[model samples]
Target: MRSLRKFLYWLNIVGMIAYLIVCGYFQMTGKPLYPGQVGLMFQVASGLVLVSIPLIIEKWAHVALPDILVVLYELFILMAILLGTGMQAYSIPNWDKFEHLFSAGMLAGSGFMIYAARTPADKQDQIDPFLIALFGAAFGVLLGVCWEFYEFTGDSLFGMNMQRYMAAGKPLIGHPVLYDTMGDLLSDFIGSAGMSLYAFFKIRRDHSWLNTFKLHRIK
Candidate 1:
């Protein structure tokens, strides 16, 4: 598992670097880059920084994140930046919605880990499992809203149309304008609820399972 995790981590980095070079070439050659392509370039660049955050925290704070969580994080970046954006997979119907759902589920799991890590070790098992599940679901939904906010801001400032507020160079109106954002939120909620339900049952069955997902402090 450790070897698999390392392999995936490096693979994502290489993918991001390759995308960056391609984007740079287009820019240098005065070629027109579509909005999605530009967004992909920016996201891939940002991913390099985002992926390093866990290692930085582990090194400086002595809080070691679980290897599975790290692997999932890297995989999410790969899917979103490389496959979804770089490969134009978003052009597929419902692909964006699928990404939102996947992201929410992953975030929900991270929420569970966060709740467990913040609790006192002695009291962890004593805490209500339902509360942990609720926290996970709520955290996922909260972040989903934040993501929508990001898209809205990007569209408002840069005309990125990230929220699908525009079509064919014309601004959408009424229900159509809200469709993409609402669908994304609904998908996110469903994903969060599904993960929370699973967590609740799993925690009730074996409290020790949560330990595998929690961050550990280095001695």
Candidate 2:
């Protein structure tokens, strides 16, 4: 875990620097960066937050997550840059759908881990795996809804049109808006549901699926 965290630490540093440089270049050249590109700046800020996750957990939550999950999240941070801001997933056909699906799964998994972390060691034997899994799945869906809200806010305030009200380079008319929103929500549901069910069944057999993942520092 330490080794993976170290690697992610440096990787984030380099990626953020390179990303900011590119954004700066676009600004200096007076090239109009897409709203997604403009959003890359915020992604860079978030990368810093991801890099700090370990420290935050160690200090506040005192939860030591598995190296694998830590690594997965670091990769997600990288994904936020490359696939999201750099590759511009929102602009590409079908990429947005894939992003929502993948993100929902990851979020569900993380939410399960967090639920486990909050469990006290003495009471862990009494913990309900099924309930936690359900909560995690619901948490993932909640995040998906919040994300749509974010897109709506962006569209309302800055004309980002992230909600696809202005889709395909033009204002969406008729059922198009409903179609786009529903599609994204559907993708979110598929991903979260799969992860939650897996966790639910797995935990029924192996309680350690959540309890003993080389995490649980507070114990």
Candidate 3:
């Protein structure tokens, strides 16, 4: 089991590296960064990093990280190709409802990971799992906001060029910096908050049920 886990861990590392290399190639070649997509290689790389953390910290043996990477990759690629030439809305072939769904899932996963990190395994009373999860989700969302800010900066003041590429089919170059970024941030907050409340309430209810169902024999 140890050997297999080690192998899988290394495999994930290699796969993430390879993914970055491909993205770098795309950047260097000046090919449409996803031709019909919004984010660049960096967005995918960020998600890969999130998936990698649990594997490295917990030594997880499962294929979760790689699987997630694959899913995100395929989704982004498909979104890019079928949607349009850039992050613009008109280019999308459909309503793109999946985009919001995927974002929520990402936030939820991030929240769960955070809770895992904060909660202790040895004792049930060590910390409130719900609180941990909530904070984790918040942190994850904050990180996302920071990333979006970085993108904004790259496209605005700097010559990142990625912004233009990312905005491919959009009618305009610059978006309302504060408005759009805040709106996205709000969405992330909602996702995290919802997951936190759900987890907290669920844990409380389960504990109540378990306590009520405990068996006691009088001798």
Task: Return the TM-score for each candidate structure.
Answer: 0.81, 0.70, 0.46
Best by TM-score: 1
What value of lDDT does candidate 3 attain over all alpha carbons? 0.48
lDDT, residue 35, model 1? 59
**Every candidate's CA RMSD:** 3.1, 4.1, 10.4
Q: Evaluate candidate 2 by giving its C-alpha RMSD to the native, one decimal.
A: 4.1
Worst ten-residue run, lDDT, model 3?
209-218
lDDT of 1: 0.82
Better candidate by TM-score, 1 or 3: 1
- Sorted by lDDT, highest first, which candidate order results? 1, 2, 3
- 31-71: candidate 3 lDDT, tens digit per residue: 74555222544554554565446445335443233233234
Candidate 2 lDDT for residue 161: 66
lDDT of 1 by residue, 144-198 (tens): 9999999999988887989998889999888899999999999899989888898
- Candidates' C-alpha lDDT: 0.82, 0.73, 0.48
| lDDT of model 1 at position 48 | 83
Q: How accurate is candidate 2 locally (lDDT)?
A: 0.73
